[model samples]
Target: MSDSQHHNEEEQAKIRTSRALAALTIAANAQISVEDACASVVDESGDEGLDAIGITLARGEIYVVQAKASSGSPSPTEVLKFNQGIRYLLDWDWDSLGGKTQKRRGEIEAASEDDVKVIAIFSHFGAQKTDEAATKLSDKLLSEVNSSGNILDFQYQGLRENHDNRNIASGLGLPDYDLVFERWITMNDYRSEIMGVVTGDQLARMVDSFNERLFDKNIRAVLKATDTNKILDATLERSPQDFWYYNNGITIVSNSISCARTSPRTADETFKLQGLSVVNGAQTCGALGRALRENAPLEDVRVTVRVMSKEGHSEDFTKKVTRYTNTQNQVTNREFVSLDPYQQELSESLLSEQIQYSFRTGQTLDYDEHAFAFDLEEATRALACLTGVDNATRAKREIGRMWSDITANPYRELFPRNLHPATMYNAVQFRRVFDERYMASSRWMDTRSGGIIKNSTYMACALFMQKARNEKLDFSDIDLDVESWVSSKGADIYGLAAIVVELHENENPGGFPMSFFKNRQKIEEFARKVRTRFQETGS
Candidate 1:
């Protein structure tokens, strides 16, 4: 072959590799394999304008991908091409399509009529333009499809700098395990499902073994260390038998499920599950894990399990089951937390001081009570700061993860049983005060300059608590004179905010302001500065 032909082939190979790598990154998110994706050389050869088009064998969902390796920003034409390809799939114009796409036409056509999830992927090596003309076209396509009563997500993987395809399946999947699902009762009313009980011991062991992956199919991420999760732990510890009746059991969606032959009536059914996901009861699962960590007794604990066998064919059906089971009259974690006596006690304590603490999800504060009303999250914020700089950083990071460990290190440190409600009230009032005075005084907080100072609020509250401790403030006494405390600590707060903001903006900080807040060393350094300032000013 001529040198020109050889060079042309090499260039073509580069383009193919680049596009395939980009496509695979997005395909990975759909749990689609590289073998499953369009890694073929002539992916863009089709007049259909898509680089890749195929359905996931596991989910029966379509993936229409458009990829390009660019030195600069990806052109608007790429999005238009992607749009053309999606429209082709919608219409199934087989006669004009390429050989590879045509081969998959039967699968595409089968899924076209159904309300399937079409992951419209646009993978590129160039920088993304969220509001560019191309982006507008992409958004238009997604909006058009989503509005048409289908779940269409445009997965954009803009691989600007890195070209590494090695991390494609870095997150492969949850393990397939065989668990004994107790006394399975086949549900005749619902198609392809079985109801059974899962012991807390077995569930806890699964959580310990699998961790977060066990809840991968769940609509919600593993909500660890929430009040609801803590409540579950408490239930298991207190009355494990009552848990089955009190708790709404978990729902599972399995890739494949096969029961052992002829188990006796009382015998636990041994089901071999190839792949599975807990579609509901993420809180229960997470709490079970926490319970195991705390060594909470799970002796008599049993949770009901309803498994919807996906079997690949029923992917659409399983999707609907995951949706309705999770959304239909769902008892929110907030509701479960509200049942905890600590919440009611805290509510009553705060109410006595003319502050309404809304703990439940649907519970609303009166318009008149807006000044004094705060929700569970707000209280967490205040308590987080009051716990001092270390726990404050954890709260800044993820307070939800800290709030549930009431029996242990983090939250137990904050809300010790003997810890006065007065202390909590004071901290909350101080939070409101700081928020009202220094934090919300200006409109520029959304700006770059203000964003720096905006992140200093938590630190400010923490510094105030530290000062209160140094001064030996009355914790047991319910003092309604929050304004007095605020008046005393106002200077310290302003000083801390100014100092922290200056340190962040002027000094070469590690990361973003929010990230800097989450950093322990950074938080400690800033706290030290604030403490030094407090000493100098003699507050």
Candidate 2:
């Protein structure tokens, strides 16, 4: 054969192998079909940086994938190019990517910006180098960002040719099983109406069969070595009997549910269930699986289960049940408010304006979930500032009080159902400027004036709003970037600083400003003094 012909053939083979490896790697990581993964791959000529990318539906995180079909792992240059590609995407430099990738701008933008993953995968030939390469990449990325908790990280994988992707091809394999529930009670049309206890042995059997796919569709459901899982591991290892009370149990949504027809089925001892998928309690299952793998003895451990059959329910309603039921126990109060219709509506409205509204504690971002975005925590602080001086003080001193009982007074009054979305946008924009300009940059000095302004941030914002409205400053706009109406009000926008400094000095002489800001009586006096200044400045 001619040398040119041999070289061309070799080049073609390399391209084919690389594309094949890309499909397999994405399928393995995302648990999607190889067909879908192949379709998402960027095969354009100039696209040397990224090979393929996808978003995880469960966590709403964007995962960028790079595949190397050569021996002994992808070279350092390939890794650097992959990192550069991700940086380009994050910076929104769409023109630098291929045409197909640029067309996906909207979908890419919609995914979680605050949390992204870049997976670097190699051919099975590189299996021996995978672990060491993965560790070095992780360490290098952390060092580059100077943050262990950064929004981006590297994950390395070696795709074995012998392994079957069939199970995972079906997407997070919770294979059709006759789910057995003990002492079950009937609740609706699909059968045993939805309450039961699942035995530990049953979970053991399922874990043995399903592996990591057991927790698909769960909220924020990536099972790692989290502190929550650590507690679960300890409990399962040492105290199996008390597991039921400590664990929040699992909530399942079945494609269909059934039971034996022997007598009235409501009081049955157990029954058959097909297509059972857990929407919550992934941590419990993971911990139990870990314990069993280590040969830890388990006794009298049963998980309380609630099943929401998808027979007649709307898609949105079923999703709501899943999101609400899946929250970590400590954040349940804040997370539960996500079920409120108003919060969802407001969230939708804010999206067009580029502001990410986070009503749920575990909510994935809509626009930008990072610090610059208008988030729920800052929104609450802004609302408290506008609500009254007392609320402002409480908001700074103890913000958790607002979210402690979402259905009750302080939370309800601050985020009433009647509250309009525009008002929230305006308030958030107003307070966000203060936080970013002063608090975030540590622009405040240890001097008394700096201390006063920094400590009384929320209260000062509240008073600023009052004075601005009297001066007729507009507050109805909601454009996040191109138009932050509140922040653009010129030098006079910070006219409240002089008033705040004077108020703090006059009301709490010789006292620490932090203590003064948190004190209700002192804040009330400060607000009164600011109002008096606003009125008397007519001179």
Candidate 3:
């Protein structure tokens, strides 16, 4: 044969070999549904039933397998049609195993190596249809297969080929048994199962369970589209040493316009420019203060920072500024060194410094869940202990408190002075914000209703802010007006309101409208009421 002809034949042979190997690999090792023709056994009670094995992923993918023996089974063409239906109903993805896309077939290649994730799959089922009607019904299931990347359907099919003769085609396997199973799983749905497989809460914490790889893809895509590198460097950083962190200090500053200032400044004015800086600075300091709080014992809390520069002038300048995270006061006195003296000559244009602050405990970022938990622990603990608590009730109460807290001040620690007004946060402002859900609880609801409750205390604070603004009023009468306004909203909104009102009212008898305070007791009580009422009652 000519070389070209021989090469062409070899290519075709490779293709056939590849296909055959794939088919055999799947048939031998893959979990499959087997059908046996003999009647299934019945219990002494004389009930008619067929038992089969199946596999499932959490709301994700499902594979059902059944085996049957038929001496005169339908043709392979007929079986292929039936297999299509099973793939559709169960929503299984076909295996391409790293191949180029097939436009006509509408097949998608696997995403990236890191991107594909295994969903929790239960097992494979095998069973024989109970009757001839059932057998024909299986034939009707052939219409559902598709090649869309977005949908999961059809993995592989297997039939018993070598076992018997006169069985015609003898055995048939369709992409993992279709048979109209119930549900498909999403990324979030398989979280628990993923947790089981990956074996680390820390890993799960860093990466989104199912969508982690997807998220990383999106982040890169966004950075690329925005040309964000030119705008700001280092999108992800494990430490302050990242290039973005040390950009010519000029580039590191936020580019947005600062707010305007007025005398006897309001938050609107203070949060604009100078006030925001002060607020952030103070918040950073506050994080340090909370870490030092007496109740929470912390160890290995250390802070060391220094700036190195090529020029002596830069060395002097570095000393003028304060450096610290929210650690202890003892950290303030750490040596602010000019490491340049210890090193060889430095250039005036270049500078570097290591500022290390470590807190073995009590280092809480303003929005960190730990910080929030610390603030809410007192109340949550007590409430959770109640005897009659239920799941729905617990969900509602906890959801309400969580939303209330998060929405009330997402950036509070970061920008305390210019805290975004609650009303301005359309995402979290509605009464329904409190009705949000955690990962698991959402499945229980048919409609998934009613989680957040803006108790009277919140209403009081909101109402106080609203009325004072509307009436061209001063906060001088905050206690009286807040109480009255909260009372008007309803007893429930007012219930927690009264407690805070009385507490604050006593702290400042002369009437102080201190906007921020940690009322842990109240926050937990609210969380408990929500957890008990919603979770226990399944409301």
For each candidate in turn, the TM-score is: 0.50, 0.47, 0.20
Name the lDDT value of residue 204 in candidate 3.
19
lDDT digits (tens) for residues 155-243 of candidate 1: 66666323443463454465576768667777552235778887888888876665434564445423533445656767888887899
Candidate 1, TM-score vs. the true structure?
0.50
Which candidate number would show the highest TM-score if scored against the true structure? 1
Taking the tens digit of each residue's C-alpha lDDT, what string does model 3 give over 1-539? 12224457766564343333222322232222123111111111111111121221111222222222223333344344334423322221222111111121231111210111111111121222233443443433322211112222222222333222113212322211101101212233221111111111211121112111111111212211111221221112223223223222210011122223232222111111110011012222222222233222222221111111223235433223323221224211012112213111111111111111111223342443221111122222222221112322232223222212322322122113332222122111121222221212223322101011121223233322333345553322212233343234343332333343444334322111211122234334543443343333322
Q: Which candidate is the best by lDDT?
A: 1
Q: Candidate 2 — which residues are off by over 4 angstroms?
A: 1-13, 59-62, 90-93, 113-124, 127-138, 146-153, 159-174, 177-180, 185-195, 199-539
Order by lDDT, highest first: 1, 2, 3
**Residue 281 CA error for candidate 3 (Å)?**
42
lDDT of residue 411 for candidate 1:
60
lDDT for model 2: 0.62
